[model samples]
Target: MTAAVFNHEGPWTEEEYLALGETQQRVELFDGSLHVTPAPTPRHQNISGELRAALRAPVREAGLHVLEAVNVRLRPGRIPIPDLVITGPIDFDELNVEAGDVRLVCEIISPSNASTDKVLKMHYYAAAGIEWYLLVEQDSGTMHLYRRRGGHYTEQSVTRPGDLLVLTEPVKATIRPEDLVP
Candidate 1:
């Protein structure tokens, strides 16, 4: 992953922003700038919804909490709202599960976000010590799996719609790219 230049719009404190009490907005803090994510595309939304649905049973049985588009505070004041997040042994009082509690982070690559997803976000997630990262690219109808290795990510596998996504940690579950396609 290449280094991302710090070019941000502005700063946002968690307190001031969380008080807004709004929903369905994807807000992130990149290099101290507030990056507001656009409403997901139809395909992106569908894929995320399906992936969340598929993981529900397994995660619940394992006594894990699954959240959609929740702010994960990667650093002191930097948070990135991942598409789907699975965390373990939670204390509901604090939802801001830092990069450590993150078991798996999934991203349904939007058309415009493909580069950010593959490059910048990939770099951040790896640096943050996320264990597993899954990317579903709609245009090519493929899923790329990555596993963190000593502060970096190694491409585990790239599978098409019909192939199953296998992971070693969190739980034994299968992900089909077709289930994630719009």
Candidate 2:
């Protein structure tokens, strides 16, 4: 839906936030506040699709679920729709996945969400005890992987265009940055 549907002047309650229902744009709830982001561009979709395809086999082999654009409830009133999530068993009937079940969350950075992805969400994901975070910077053709350490995230690796991103913790998979785009 449109932002007009959320014309209230105060912070939204979790019930109200959920009541807003499926939106055309990406909508998240943080501290009772709503953060609305525009739908991703075609290039962003291409990268997400490609990355998901690359991770699918290995992630599934590890007995994990790799999902796209799914609601992740970090805590009460703190639900974020991550671009990609590698999670443990979750019932398909549930509206969202719990933070405890999630192993990794990935976000493909675009101009509009660079800061949020690189900083804000990083802190949130780490604080919630999620083990890994993957960031794909489309403009630079790079991917940065982070591992959680003591309520914070430490950079695990940075893979550039010509190199392969080899990950083994959550799953064993290798991906090339350039291959993320068409």
Candidate 3:
């Protein structure tokens, strides 16, 4: 694995970011700046795990790849580590997957970084042509599912704990929001 660039002072290029060493804490690049975020809380992991479990079977059956907490390199200076990401076959020895290689990207909104997940990262995902973006809210098990169209992500469904999320765009998976909560 390449070192995660650890600079937040000024804007840095993606090459510069990748050449840097990794940090003990989880780090990500956004708009040429490095942002260090703490490891996921137990609650966050629970939610992420549940969602990953739910999608794994279907994704695999469809011959797609799913991973958690991996880097989606949208472009230079705009690399975001989504909580969960589903994409096509990935090459070995590749440090990061390009956004274009992604079919779907999911983020379990971290309370400390909800805004970035909702706004900045969402914009980056959309611009990169990722077709699906699943936003998981831990506490309520609410999901704001999105699909890219016209260069933006629009809500495909707003599902709650009681509702089943049926997705057909990126893949076919029937998921329950409550099942994703810890």
What local distance difference test score does each model get?
A: 0.77, 0.90, 0.84
Whose lDDT is higher: candidate 1's or candidate 2's? 2
Output the better candidate (1/3) by TM-score: 3
Task: Give Cα distance to truth, residue 33, candidate 2, Å.
Answer: 0.9
Quote model 2's TM-score: 0.96
Candidate 2 segments whose C-alpha is farther than 4 A from its true place: 3-6
Tens-digit per-residue lDDT, 1-182, candidate 1: 01121332346566644544444557676765666677888878788888888888888888787778877878876778888889887666775777888898988888777888888888999999898888888765588888999988998899886677775568667877777776
Ranking by TM-score: 2, 3, 1
> Which number leads on lDDT?
2
How much is the lDDT of residue 146 in candidate 2? 94
lDDT of 3 by residue, 1-182 (tens): 22334323567778776776565667788886678888899999999888989988999988998899877789767887899998888884687898888999998888899998999889889999999999989798899999999789999899997899998856799998878786
Better of 2 and 3 by TM-score: 2
Determine which window of 10 residues in candidate 1 has minimal summed lDDT: 1-10
How big is the positional error of residue 36 in model 3, measured in Å on the Cα after superposition? 1.1
* Residue pairs in clash, model 1: none
TM-scores for candidates 1 onward, in order:
0.85, 0.96, 0.91
Model with the higher TM-score, candidate 1 or 2: 2
